[model samples]
Target: MTNFKITLYTDPVCAWCFIGHRTLDQAITLYQRTYPGGRHDMFEFIYHPFYLRNTKPEEGRMTLEDAMLAKNGTEAKVLAIKTKMQRIGTAHGILFNYDSKVGSTKLAHVLIQQAGRHRGAEVQKEMVGAMYSMHFEQGGNINNLDELVAVAVKVGVSEQDAHAWLRDDQVGAEVDELARTAREELGVTSVPTIEIGGLRLEGAEDVGGIMEALVSVKEKEIAVGGAQDPF
Candidate 1:
């Protein structure tokens, strides 16, 4: 069996990233059903860090709505963007809370890194999904160490370990560097950038688009007899 590595660069607080996460899951389910028998084990998912706001810890937390208004320069524009995001999220079974708090995602990314190191990819994915739900649906402040740790614990991470990892300056710095490398080296200019089988899908593509990309990649890989990378 051939293996396909799927790398997702995302920020926890991004609404589109949340939507993309769910959409990718749906697409993977459909792909597995279409090509069953060991196909499920043929895919490996890895999550990387990307910062949309990159707010400093000292800057503290602000309401997501306030941040958007500041960036978009008008209440109407912010409302329109929120409406669009909410509509898209709802279509993917995600309930977005525009009123949630926004702050530095450094600690959150560190938590995910630690989760992946300790628990593996599936558990790491669970931690990611929980973080998205906390930030988007429950209005939780992921920037807060306690809040992040709480979510981690719920996803099989020990509270002590979560607290230690988040409080580690080295881990936080590593996460920051990774986000920067993703932008500079990986050419990831936006959140929810997905890479699979050498094909890159930018932003939150719909399920159909993602599925098509997957199929195209699979076909190309097969055509090449899995001897070379399929772009």
Candidate 2:
């Protein structure tokens, strides 16, 4: 019986972060199917907010091609990422349109912090997925307060509370705190950084690789406990 904490660090508007989400979901689903509740208490996955663009919603607006050009990404790189995101998203039944434009995710993360406080952690998770869907799947602007509130309500966060969090600036402080944790505290310089058992799992990893890492961590914990226990 080993306990593992996996922190998923991501931003709402990131393409690869969306891919990482689908990858993690697939890996976890496959792990569950393979284990079938046998390791119920083995691992706990938590979503942590990371803001890729801290700009104002209006200032962050850019088309997909424009963003790629800014990042020095070539057409081949763009197409490769597009294909990868679409493939991974489809595997999880998540629709993602990479051609769309998305703005700053500060408001989205503000809703997430509020969801974690009022509703529950899972609500925050749903909100994250919804933001990703809106940007990557529907090409909707996640920076809009309306979209933020919509996702918040869908995730069980109170609508009135959602409006407060979005329009009234109630959750701005909390969003700042999380952003600080993601940036200064945790030393996260990029989006889509995953941590498992206090170990960082960044970028995209295949299902087999992720599963192997999980199992390896579990085995190490068991071995260490067996060595330390005395009775």
Candidate 3:
């Protein structure tokens, strides 16, 4: 009956984060099946925003190819990266479409925060997944307000509420501050940084690694009389 919180710092547009998300789910399922009395409800997942690209909404969206070319300095390198991503992503049950748009994830992060505050952690997690799918699968623009609101509606948030929250300067500011804290204070420079029971797994760790980490944390908690402080 012990409760554990798993905090994930991720950006919606990160290809590795998308893979890590699915890998984490597989690891959790493996843990529950392998360990006696391991219930899904015992773990709570909380997602925080970590910006990979800080493009503002006013800057508009850039095609994924253009962004990659700008970063890698050549089309060949970009294609190689995309091909590698597709290979790895296919293994993880994610189909990555590099024809998507890339832009600021601030609104998407704000939506996730609002989901957690209003709907609970599960909904918040669902919203994050939805956002990832929107960008990586559907090739939608994450920075577009209308697209963000549509995602919110799909995740059980009212259209009116989604519009209101995205327009709120205070809420947007809070999301920005959270990203700042994750980067500056927490030393998280990468996306898909997952923390469980004070142990961290950076980047897109494979399913086996994540499962081992989960087991290690659970065993440690049991050994210490379940008194370990939360992360």
Candidate 4:
């Protein structure tokens, strides 16, 4: 029986999703330090595939630069947003590198879903962080199969296993189905949409607020003698 469960819907190339992850990561660290009783295991963090570009599979994906340019209408405005993102990330001890050529994340989502199936949540988290860092920090093309395979291998998912998973059409189908369900059923139109303690939080929500919500939920569950139930 876990104290709580958090289901995070995200995409690999999404900057805000990465920030949300960092925020929760920091909060968990703080919570552990304050409790110091291995209470971290009482919570489960699960990642789900949310392909932002899945609506139109046939239409080609947009590059990060193109998307930014479309929104800002000028390179100068785009650069300003980039600088603002860096400042915001730095204030929270997080990094937001805008150097990667962001393209389709369909394949990356497939790999993440596969990782969750075979390697479990911790490994999936590692894969998520690796993919995010590869794209956001090292400017790697996450859409590239070779680069994705490299990231999979780097995260302890064997190269052979990753190749096999990628080659499996059923696995890819499962990932697509999950993404579809998220959009059609959960109404998740954005990245970093987290369902925690029966509440769905969108975007980069405050860490302190999330922690407070978790604590409140846990207390209620305990009071109701439902702490033994799986969250």
Q: Regarding lDDT, does 1 or 4 come out ahead?
A: 1
Stretches of model 2 off by over 4 angstroms after superposition = 1-3, 36-39, 73-77, 167-170, 226-231
lDDT scores in order: 0.84, 0.71, 0.85, 0.77
Residues 3-94 of candidate 4 have per-residue lDDT tens digits of 56889999887888878878888777766555334264466777788887533433334556677897679999988888877987887776
Q: Which of the numbered candidates is closest to the native, going by highest lDDT?
A: 3
Off by over 4 Å in 3: 227-231
- Candidate 3 vs candidate 4, lDDT winner: 3
Model 3 scores a TM of 0.94
Q: Give the Å shift of residue 48 in candidate 2.
A: 2.7
What does candidate 1 score on TM? 0.92
**Residue by residue across 156-218, what tens digits does model 2's lDDT show?**
777788888776464676667777888998899886888877668778677777777666666
Backbone clash pairs for candidate 3 read none
* Better structure of 1 and 4 per TM-score: 1
Q: What is the TM-score of each candidate against the true structure?
A: 0.92, 0.82, 0.94, 0.87
Put down candidate 1 lDDT per residue, 174-223, tens digits, no spaces.
88899989999989999899998888999899888888888877777669
Error of 4 at 123 (Å): 1.0
